[model samples]
Target: MAGGTVLVVGGGLAGITAALGLADAGRSVTLVEARPRLGGLTHSFRRSSRAGDLWVDNGQHVFLRCCTSYRRLLDRLGVSDLVSLQPRMDIPVRSGASPRVARLRRSALPAPLHLAGALAAYRWLPPAARVSAARAALALGSVDPDDPAVDEESFGRWLARRGQGPRAVEALWDLVGVATLNAPAERASLALAATVFQLGLLESNDAGDIGWVRVPLQRLHGDAAARALAAAGVRVELRTRVGRLPTTYDDVVVATGPAVSEDLLPGDALDLAPGWSARLGSSPIVNVHVVLDSAVLDEPFVAAVDSPLQWVFDRTAGSGLDPATGQYLALSLSAAEELLGRSVAELREWTLPELGRLLPRSRSARVLDFFVTREPQATFRAAPGSRKWRPATATRLPGLHLAGAWTDTGWPATMEGAVRSGEAAVASVLGRRTERTALGATA
Candidate 1:
């Protein structure tokens, strides 16, 4: 994996990061993708409109300020402004709620106090629920990172122990779950939840600041990544799905989907007990794309706490959709297990009513068109006792390094985690000169 040439299989951020890092280090790198695009889930496409042209993303994706590696990736792409960063954490939880907002602002005070205003002002939770949520946060803040039991219990169990009922869990922890594991907190491991929340929310001020691309996902991720990698002398091939890895190619890297990697591994990967071992199950993310005649959601994004929609992102400006003409809304329904195998028509019938209820403007608005996209293996099931299932960056095979959101990057299965995992693969593949060469923009 060190000297001659390295083949990176996958065109996602993982592969792009690895290819850029490796090629910049003077290694011959070839990146291959089964799809015509490289951004994977974050890719975008165009839609025709009466006013003009419209661009929309495949899914609604967001990152926190804590995602430094991802931030660096954007900076290196020279499109840092292409994504909008919230100065603080401003989550409009529910429109029906009295205050209808929650802002997790970073303060001049210490880290704990920085969160006090947010917790104290969280109007979504009842007064008792708010106090209980504070205690829960304290409990999570104090958990030892190295504790074995931390990885064994579900976050729901921990919250239940701390007196969080279903109502509170929905208002509080489920949102955390959607942002972290992309699964319900009740079904996710306490360790992963604590890791995500403590690091992203409680431990650091400015940690929960939100960032979403202000362009089509493909433009922001795949197209831009391809240009950057090509500039670094990496050959990127799309629409070349790799079914298996060549065993003889010792310096190869597998940045493909986890299922693809599991299908290609030559060694006793299961016997070695990778972190992905425990998280064998998959979760579904169903993003219902709604094309509105006019802008329905004025906010850039909103988290639907009381509705069937987990989160909604207004990609009108960024998706290339003319705000004056049409709007594109990406509805992300996480842990959509039951809805995975359904048809787009079925989803529309089921979803539109709920969305319209949450956003009164949509009541009389005729949906120009609607579609549904599903990711069956969107994320590895981060249930209790599931941490060990994540694979390592350095695999059993020398050339076959691994990169995915599911990798043991200590971060949740997020864009940040994906970037962190890619960075790890990059650092590993560059070898000696990595410190001097590949680490240029990344470090």
Candidate 2:
């Protein structure tokens, strides 16, 4: 525990979290990052605004009330005041020719009773559907995440058996799936969807309430994390990728990508040997940003009820813009496997019309150019039966810990997972002893 220096080889939120956690715990550490800046996927840059220079996130990210760990990170970084938490469970879902909005609220009745009150008065649902949706929610909440059968059935199948038909599923249950997993009901795993619900809704009355960033992703996450780490006396190095570990010593953290992890260890030990580690897969995300003449959206973030666009975020005030001619909107397409290879032009062809259709005022709005960004492997594919593949924070290699959203953090591959993985990696590193990694055909 004395006179030991650790090297963490990444600068994403997880890496930053690990470094800071270790440093705060009285450990000396150096962080190496491959990119010029930190923040990994959540980044921002200068964009033109009527009020002058502006910053906006690549895409908006939101959290549920139950995400206590994430909130604690914000508080530690002193940015808690920069965000807003929806005080009540309010979901505004809209679809089709005429937009219909339904807001889900809670009552003092408690647990299933609160859910029943919200569902009984849910106007968008038919009388029969309201009852069916309630039953389905109850059924989903009652299902145990530990049960093997939960992962065997598709969420769509489970919903259907619980009385949710196609339209009702799209309007109600699908919102739950896509809002959480970034996939529609049919595409997502029943176990994952149920976990999202059980953890978010049934477990607590206001836990499903949303919280989103009031500023750009990079400023809110990367810059804040880097600054906090530096203040804590952590050495933060960016653009210095580590291809191999300093084998001269036995204590270090490998927080890089799949290739780097495999490159560092003996006999291709980190290569996962086509087993647990090798089984890691990824999903794609597509983000589109557009500027209009006026504020097209008021909410900080919104999940598209029954559309291919999973979520949308409004960046007006945060971008230093006048509401009239300086409103920016970002659309995030999660699990965007189909749209991964499409050109931005082809994407805009369909997306622009959809946006206009959703926000009628945008029909007459002037186009201030558009931009789209795609990440083919933004996160690990969290499909059914895939849970067994996600590894823990510690590996067989001593002093070599893993930190990423893919690790088993009892959460979907998310920002929270990334932060949690980093914290776990640090804990594992701090507990390391005089032992070293074996140099044999490791796995």
**lDDT tens digits, residue span 1-443, model 1:** 34567788888877777777777667888888899888876787777655456676767788888889989888877779788898877777764433255654556566767777777787777888888888888888987655668888888888899999998888778876765687787788888888888878887778888888877788888888878988887887777866656543326777776666776665454345443433466777888888888877878888866777778888777766666766778888888898888888788888888887777778687787687777788877877776666777875434457888878787777888888888899776655222212211100
State TM-scores per candidate. Answer: 0.90, 0.90
Q: What is the C-alpha lDDT of each candidate?
A: 0.75, 0.73
Off by over 4 Å in 1: 1-3, 49-53, 95-106, 247-250, 269-279, 431-443
Q: Which lDDT tens digits does candidate 2 get at residues 333-389? A: 887888888887898898988887677677887767577877787776667766666
TM-score of 1: 0.90
- The TM-score of predicted model 2 comes to 0.90
